[model samples]
Target: MNNLTTEPDMHTALWSLVRNNNKLFSQKRNLEKFRTLLNIISENGTIEDLINIMSIFLYGNNAQKELIENTCLPCLRKLPCEDLPKLDERLRSSISYAGWNINETTDWKQKPSLFELCILACHPNGYTRERAVTALANHYEPVALAIALIRCNDWVSPIRISARDTAVNIIARINTDELMKVWIVFDRVSHGQRHGDISLSKTLFPLLRERIPSNELHLQLESGNSRTRRYAAEVMWHTHQSLNYSDLQALCACSDPYVCFRTMRDILPRLDQRVRTKLLDLVKTKKWAPARLERLRLLMTDQPECMHDELLDALCDRSASVRNFARFHLKEHSDVDMELHYQRKLESPNISTRIAALAGLTEIGSPIVADHAKRWLKEENPRIVAAGLSALPAEVIDNCEDHILKKVTNHSLQISKAAYIALCNSPPLSAKITPYFQRDDLSERQSIYFANLLLLQSRWEAVAHAISFCRHNSKEVNKCGVFWLQRWVYGERKFWMTPSKSDLQDIHRELELSHSNMTEALMKEIRFLLDSYQ
Candidate 1:
């Protein structure tokens, strides 16, 4: 110790002790040297001298924190630049221990300086910078919040998240005079309210709801980006607060299903016992369920028990994503059989519910459930109508004979295509739908339907299916298959034909060569159809 002549020599020696404070402190000789070094720095050290000594102990063993905080923190803050790294460490220590209301309960004057906090907030090190933010939030000091606001745009994700979180908490705790300053800081943020997550509607509403006009918040709720709308919903329900019933109802729309679903997840659990049931009842209207795919997923994931009826309705959701998820949940989790679930949802006013139930029933190989699904033919939503025409079982199509005859003409081509697919998909439907072509009331739509149904041989490949269709058991169906094959083979209407001459010849050769599965009647019919080309 006596051999060390310069201040730098002692500084280097002190740093060595700080790094190995616990290990060195136990030895009698090193402890005497460490105490002598602390005494020399305490008596006559420069800002850098004080900082070097203070940081050594501050970061050393746990037993040294009080000496650094009580003996060194006061003199260090006033240092030039405070040397940014050391300033950062100070802020980190402050954030870890500062009381939320230390300003009021304590002398309130001797806390970490706001200037130090602001500087640390802008520090390059993300780790210490986030900790600085936590300190600002805890201090809830009015002035440091500006730095917090700037951090809302932090380049790193977690830093930005921390800044926004602290800003909200600070704003929530500040006085009106100080809180008003947030708008000024926000004004400087690029596109301020237009951005996601950073918008006032999101970052402010939950914390500063009392200051923001309710009408403006509602407007943002309706028109804001998904994140803004999400937060607006959170604020609205923070203390069981709510927007108008219709607005709450509107939140369930599909345009922003993910957001709508999240808001509902939070909102549903908080409603009064009486209103909760009514809220569930309102969702049953189908309009609520229509576009909310995101809602269904979260509901199914986090709180499946709350979504029982909605899950049932979801089995018929217009969105395949929702319906698929619902079916998965029911099949894996619910004891309820597919038949019973389908029958229950069959009468839901939600046309999708009805259609989905029918689809679900048919999927699990349930018998024809045409009565329940037939009503979907008149559903205004084209999706529901399309599902109705196709998702039914084969016998269901046979029983709802008249309804199919009528719906075939008036609905969309998508629906008509669906009907073609639906009728042909079922063997029973093959017999049932064939009879419709002979009807006197065939409109152009009806004409298209019958023509397509009769001409359609395979849902997958046209030429190959045409040959197979010619071999169908029913004579009318076989005759119809031949007629369409002739149209395709001869140059009658090029639009209806898909197979080339070579492909037809190849099929003919293959058919004659392989006659085992080809019944005598079907082979004869195919031979007659092929004779025209020959």
Candidate 2:
């Protein structure tokens, strides 16, 4: 037999074996055909062929499994070596087809044992855990799916996506308390999206809406656990179906303040005006504790002018949420009111309210308001002073420059930051501010900001004056000076002081001989700079 006749015969024979499988591993043709079959279909196979190949590998007989275990799997374990490049190339193409079909292999009729999944979930390879998490959607066992959902968050990007989408399957169908466990998992991570972004809402929200008639979702919404209830309130408005009006009324009157607030913010806006009015009437008559105060929001919505006094009274409400609501609502009105109705609010006993009021005045930008607010700078309350600094008009800013420079080193960080930001804007204040950078009481951060400003405005002599603090007794102060030196090297064109090897040497010489107290810290900083530069 010549090679030509033998090759075609071999191809025809192996394809026939693939079409009808028996555990016939005895032939060398089987091994060559297996690799050949994967390679031919690997790059350009039809969807049907890919599916068949996937099923072959996943549920194929012992010989096919052994073929992968011995051949492509070993090559894929490392990068493509030069000697056997064809093997590496074929292995990679085959593995891509294999990975693409992981979700299709899930057996919904029987949940895998916890021990098996635990190993996959705990696997160091991200792709393995990704497969395990995504496969949970077809899983029949609720508790097992819940456990896998928690582990999905630990995997890489692909796994996290599978975890998020599969979460909807578990969330929509799971029983009351079971879904709460998923919510607990969600809260541990920082990101959750609604609509077209990263959230269980894309599926779970619609499913919950569909399943509402079952009362299962309702039970979770009203769960004894506050966290579960909170999740319900948060996600309730995201569904395609509107929440039932009676359900909204009841949740608004819920004992949980968080639930009530969430209902008012999310659910109430979509309610009919007549329904809100009727609910407000019923709550006012019934004196529902959790929701009675929520009536102020409706009043603000329908008759905002009539609700001004009531909102003012709410500012004193003991609940922080209520106070925040009042502050925000009042600021909204202050935007339009020529009277600045919240003026009295600047003196409101609550510090947050006072800050909000001052901020309102700031945005309004009335010189008259600044005149009244400037007294806040002298009041000794640093928060009030900070607000005053932010609220002042440019015309009035110079009048307060001397006072602002003093507060740059004020014990209150908020006041000091406001003072630094305000002075940095006024070039005249730069002269007055430079000397304070060297004062022992000044914070290192304060000095860095001050020094940077001087350089930013071409005040080279000021930075030269304060260069000694690079070896200051305060470690924080020394660190700040070193950071400034670093900024100079990175080459900011606006600065007056440019970094040079000779210039740094001269400064180092002065520090070593003139300042014996901080030789070590200074040397450490210089060495770090030298290493980084090189």
Q: Please give the RMSD to the true structure for each candidate, in Å.
A: 21.5, 14.8
Cα lDDT tens digits, model 2, 191-285, are 43322334555655566556444255456667787766666665566762566776666566555677766666666666777777765664442
lDDT of 1 by residue, 241-283 (tens): 6355655555544245554555567666655655544454444
Best by lDDT: 1
- Model 2 clash pairs? none
Best by TM-score: 2
Q: How far is candidate 1 from the true structure (C-alpha RMSD, Å)?
A: 21.5
Per-candidate TM-scores read 0.34, 0.48
Worst window of 10 by summed lDDT in candidate 2: 76-85
Full-model lDDT, candidate 2: 0.56
